[model samples]
Target: MSAPLEGVRVIDLTHHLGGPLATMALAQLGADVVKVEPPEGDQWRAVDDVRGESRVFHAVNRGKRGVVLDLGTEEGRAALHRLVDGADVLVHSFAPGVAERLGAGAAELTGRNPRLVHCSLSAFGPGGRRGTDVALQSESGLVAANGGRVMPVPAHDTVAPWIMVSGILAALLERERSGRGQVVETSLLEASAALAAHRLIEEDSGEPLFNRFVGALYRTYRTADGAVALACYAPRLHARALTALGLGHLLDDPRFADLPSRARHSDELAVLIGERLAAEPSANWLTALDAAGLPHGEVADRPFSLLDHPDAAAIGLVVEVDDPTLGRERATGPPLRFSRTPPRPGGPAPRLGEHTAEVVGVSVGAGGGR
Candidate 1:
C-alpha cells in the first residue's frame, strides 16, 4: 500500500528537539518535508559539546530535504512564501512572538498559504511565558518527581515533542473534512502535566501522591547478579510474586492484607523482598517471575544495543540508513506499526542546503551564500 502521507508536503521551519521531532514524525510517515534553516543553519548544529558537528541534528533530521532561507531578509521571506504556496504544513519551535518578529508569523504565513497546517511548539502555554529546557523540566515537577534531584536526561524535552505531534495530527485529520488548515499549539508544560496526571494531588494533607512508594511490589530489587524492576499491581500477581519467591507466608500477614496496608508498611516489606532477591541472580528471579506471569524487567547498566536482540528486529525498531557525512549507520525507525503502509526509514540528513535547488526550484547555493 502507498504511504498515508505520500502526497503531503511539509515546510519545516522548526529547530532543536521538540519542533524537529514533530516534523520528523511526519517525514517518517512519507511526507515531503523541506527543512528551512537560516544562513548559518540551525543554531543547534553548533552545539558546543558536539565539536562543530551535531549527531542529535542528524538523528532527528533524517529522511527529509533541506533549504537555507534567510527569513531575516526580504529575499528569505520571499523564498518562504514561495515554498509555502506549494506546501501542506509548516512547523516551528520559536517562542510565541519570535515568528512575527521574523515576518513568519501565523497571519503572514496563513495569508500566503491558507490551507497550511501551522504548528508551533513552545516551552510554556501559547503566548503565556517563555522557558528553557531546564526551566520547563523544573516547572513541570519532573525535577520534584525525582525527590528534588535533577534528572539525568532531558525527560521533559523528550515528551514535549510528542505532544506537538499529537496536535499536528489532529489538525491534519480535521483538514481532511474542512479543507482549511488551522494552527496547532503544544507546550512542554502541558506534556509534563499530562504525564504527571496520576501523581498530581488535589489536596496534600501529608499524602503527596508520588512522595514515596506505595508498596514493595513497584520497585527494583538487586539480585546476586544485576537488578530487576518488578511492578505487579494486581493482587493476584502480588500473591504470585510472594509465592514464586518462597515468601508465601506474607499472604496471611495482617500488615500485608491490602494495598493500603502493604503501602503503609512498604519499608518492612522492602527489606523482606530485598533479602530474598539478593540470594539469587536476577536471571533466576526472572524465570520465576515470568512463570508466575508477574510483570518484571532486568535493569540495564549500559546503553541498550539492539544489534544482537531478536525482539528488537522482530518489532522493526532498527533500520539501516546512509548518512552523507557519517556514511551508513543503523538508526531507529518509527515506533508505531501499520499493517497497510508501514513507516519506511530513508537516507541520511542533508548537507546544509543540499537539496535547495531541487526543493525550491531555484539556483540557490549551499548555506545562505547564493
Candidate 2:
C-alpha cells in the first residue's frame, strides 16, 4: 500500500538538525521530499569528520532525494523557483531576512503557489523586539526548566523539530478546508517556552514550591552498583516504596505520614532510602520494587549501541541502508505507524550534488550553477 502523503511533494531547503528533522518527519509520512543543499552541501555533511559524511546527517536525511543549488546565484535561485512551483510544501531554516534576500520568502512563494504550505523554523520568532535576535538553547527557558539551576542537555533542539512538524501538519489540515495554504512559523525559543508550560504555571500560581528541588518524590537514588530512579506518586505506592526498602516503620511515623510532610523532609528521607537501597544491587532492588508495587527503574550508564535490540527490531524502530561510501549503515526509523499505509524507509542520504543532473537536468560546478 502507498503512504498517506504519497502524492504530496515537499521542497526541503533546510540545514542542520531543526529544519532537516522537520522535513524528515514529512518524508516519513510518504511525502516526496527533495532536499536542496548548497554547492558545498549541508553543514551536517562534514559535521565532525572529513570523510564527507556524518551519521547524524544521514539519520535525519534518510527517505529523501537530494539536490544541490546555490540560491546566492541568480541561475540557482531561478532553478529553486521551478522546484517550488511544483511543490505542495516548502521548509526553510535560514536566519531572519535570509529567505527574503534569497527570493524564497513566504510572500513571494505563496504568491506563486497559493496552495503551498510554507514552514519556517528559526532560533527566535518573527515577532517582538528580540525577534531577529539569535536565541540559543541556553537563552531558551527549556534549559532552565530541564536542568533546574544547572546546565543539562539542551532538549529544545531535538524537541523544536517535532514542534515545527506539528505546525506544518496543522497548516496542511487547515488548508484542506480553507483551500488556501498558510505560513506556519515556529522558533526554538517559542517551542522551549511551551515545553516549560507546567513550570511556568506553577511559578504564576505563587506556590513556587512546585519547582523546588526538594518537592520531588520521584528522583535518582544511589544503589549498590549504580544509580536508580524511583517514582512513587500515590500515597499507597509511597508506602509500598518504603516497604520495598525494608523501611515500613517509616510509614507509621507522624513526621513522615503525609505527602506534604514527606516533601518537607525529602532530603532526610532520601538519605535514609539511599542507605537501604545501597544494601541491594540495582537488579535485585528493581525486582523487589516491582513485587512491592513501587515504581523504579535502573539508570542506563552508557549510550545504547545499535548492534541489535529486540524491541527496536520488533517495533520497526531501526532500519538499515546501504551507502556507496560508508558501505552499510543503520538509522532510526519513522516515528509514526498506520494500519493501511505504513511508512517505508528510503535510501541512504545522498552524496553532494548526487541528484543535480536528475532533479535539475544540469551538472554541478565548483562555484555552483551549471
Candidate 3:
C-alpha cells in the first residue's frame, strides 16, 4: 500500500507555527506540500525565540518545498492561482480580510479550483466586527485561566495545528465521495475551548475547579538525584507501587485509610513518598519500580542533544531531519504508523524561495523578493 496522501499536493499559505505545522503533518503523511511565503519569508523566520536559533522556522516548516511570492503584485497573485489549479488542498493562517486583499481569499481560490479542500487557521473565526493583534494564548482565554500568565504549551499555537490537520483530513475524506471540496475552518478560539471540553458537558456548580493535581502517587516527585513521574491510579498498580516503595504500611494509617482518604491526604502522601524517595537516587527507584512492575520512570527535560537522552532513539519518539542550513536536527515524527504504507522521512525544510523558479516559473530575485 502507498502512503495515505502519496499523490496529494498542498499549498500552504500559512506563516507561523499553527498553519505550517499543520501542513508539515500532511507532508509527513506523504503530501507534496509546497509552502508559499511572502517576499520577506514567513514571519516566523524573523522570530528569535531561542537567541540565534531558527526554532520557529526550521522546526515547524520542515518536510516541504518553499517558494517566495510578493502577493502585493499581480504577477505573484497570478502565480498563486496557477499553483491552486494543480493543488488538492490549500491552507492559510492569514488574519481577517487579509487574504481577500491579497487575492488569495477562499472564494477566489475555490473559483480557480473547486475541488480544493481549503483549510483556514485563524486567531479568531472568519469574519468579525474588528480584530486585534494578540498572542494566541490570550485570544484563546488560556491566560485568564492560568491567572494571567501565558503558558507556552498546549495553547492554540501548538494544539490548533493538529486541529487543522484533522480538519484537512476530514475535508479530504468528504471530497472522496462528494466529488467536491469544501471549506474547513478552525481557530485558536475553538482550539482553546476544546481543551476544556469537560467544562462544556459537566454541570455548572458555579465554582471554579482548576489545578486538580492533588492525588497521591499520581504526580511527579523528586528523588535523591532526579525526579520520578508516577502513575498509580489503577487499583492493582496502586497496591503494587506501595509494595514496591515499601510503604504498604500507609494503608493502615487513619488519615490515609482508603482510596478516598488517600486522595484527601495527597499532600501528606507526597511528603511521605518524598521522604523515602530522598533516600535513594532516581536510578534505584526506577530499578525498584521496574522490578515491582509499577508504572513509573524518571522525569526528563528537553534534550539539548541525543546524548542527553539515549532513550530517545530507543523509543522512536523523535525523528532526525537533515536541515539544509541547520544541519541534522531532531523533530517530532508523524504521530501515526500504518502497517503497510508507513510514512517515510521527508526532505529537509527548504531555503527561502529555493524552489521559486521550479515551482512558480519565475525567480524571486527577479523582483528583489526575499
Candidate 4:
C-alpha cells in the first residue's frame, strides 16, 4: 500500500535532536520532507562527542532531501519562502524570536500558505528561557525522582520529537475540516512533564509512593550469578512470586497482607526476597518467575546489547542500515505500523546539503542565489 503521507510536502528548518527527528518521522510516513540546513551544517554535526563524525545526526535524519540556505542573507530568506509557499507543513526548532528574525515565523508562513501545518519545536514553551534536555530533566524533577542519577539518554529531547510528530498530525487532521492550518507547538519542558505525568500527582494524604523502580518487590535484585528485575505489582503476582521463590509463608504475614501493607514493610520484604534470590542463579529464578507469570527481565551487561536478540529481530524492531559516516549500523525500525497505509523504513540519512541541487534547482553554493 502507498504510505499514508504520500503527497504531503514538508519544509524542515529544524536542527539537533527534537526538530530533525520529528521531521524524519514525517518523512518515514512518506512525506516529501526537504531538510534545510545553513551553510555551516547542523549544530549536531559539530558536537565534540564523535570528533570527526556525528552519529546523532545520522540516527534521526533519514529519508529526506537536503538543501543549504544561508538564512542570514536576503537571498536565502527569499528562497526559503518560495519553498514554504508550496509546502503542506513547515517545522522549525528556532528559539522564540529567531524564526521571526529569519522571516520563517509561524504567522508569516501560515499567512503565505494558509493550508500549512506550522509546528515549532522549542527548548522551552514560548516566553521561557531556552534550556537543554539535561537541564529540563532536573527542572522537571526527573533527576531527583531517579535518585539524583541522570539518565543516560536525554529523555526530554528524545520524547519531544515524538510528541511534536503527534501534534503535527493532529493539526493536519484538524486542517482538513477548517480548510486552514494553525500553529502546533511543543517543548522539551512539555515533553518532560508528559514523561513523568504519572508521578506529577498530588495527594492530601501524603506524597504517593514513587516505587515503580525501587519498590522492594518490584526492583532488580542480585541473584547468585547474575541480576534479574522482578515486578510483583498486583496481589496475584505477589502471591505467585512468593510461592515461586519458596517463600509462600510470607503470604500469611500481616505486614505483607496487601499492597499498602507490603509497601510499608517493603524493606523487610526486600531483605526476605533478596536473600532468597541470592541463594540461586538468575536462570533458576527466571524460570520460576516465568512459571508464576510474574513480570521479570534479565539485566544485560551492556546497553543496546539486546539489539541482536532473536525476538527483537523477529518482531522487526531492529533494522540494518549502511550509513556513509557510521558505516553499516543497526538501528530501530518505524515506531508503529498500519494495516493498509504503513510507514516505510527510510533509507540512510542524507549528507549535509546532499540534495541541494536536486531540491532547489541550484548547487549547494549557488543556493544563496535561489
Name the top lDDT candidate: 4
- Candidate 4 per-residue C-alpha lDDT over 186-220 given as tens digits, one digit per residue, 9 for 90 to 100: 89989988998876777787655564223787789
Between candidates 1 and 3, the one scoring higher on TM-score is 1
> All predictions: root-mean-square deviation over Cα?
2.6, 3.1, 3.3, 2.7
TM-score of 4: 0.93
Off by over 4 Å in 1: 48-52, 201-213, 304-309, 363-370
The superposed Cα distance between candidate 4 and the true structure at residue 319, in angstroms, equals 0.9
11-58 per-residue lDDT for model 3 (tens digits): 999987778888988898889999988877886776764333466687
| TM-scores, all models, native as reference | 0.92, 0.89, 0.87, 0.93
How do the residues 212-259 of candidate 2 rate in per-residue lDDT, one tens digit apiece?
A: 334334888778898788887566577767877788898788757777
Q: Rank the candidates by TM-score, best first.
A: 4, 1, 2, 3
Candidate 1 to truth, TM: 0.92
TM-score of 3: 0.87
> Candidate 3 — which pairs collide?
none
**How far out, in Å, is residue 135 in model 4?**
0.8
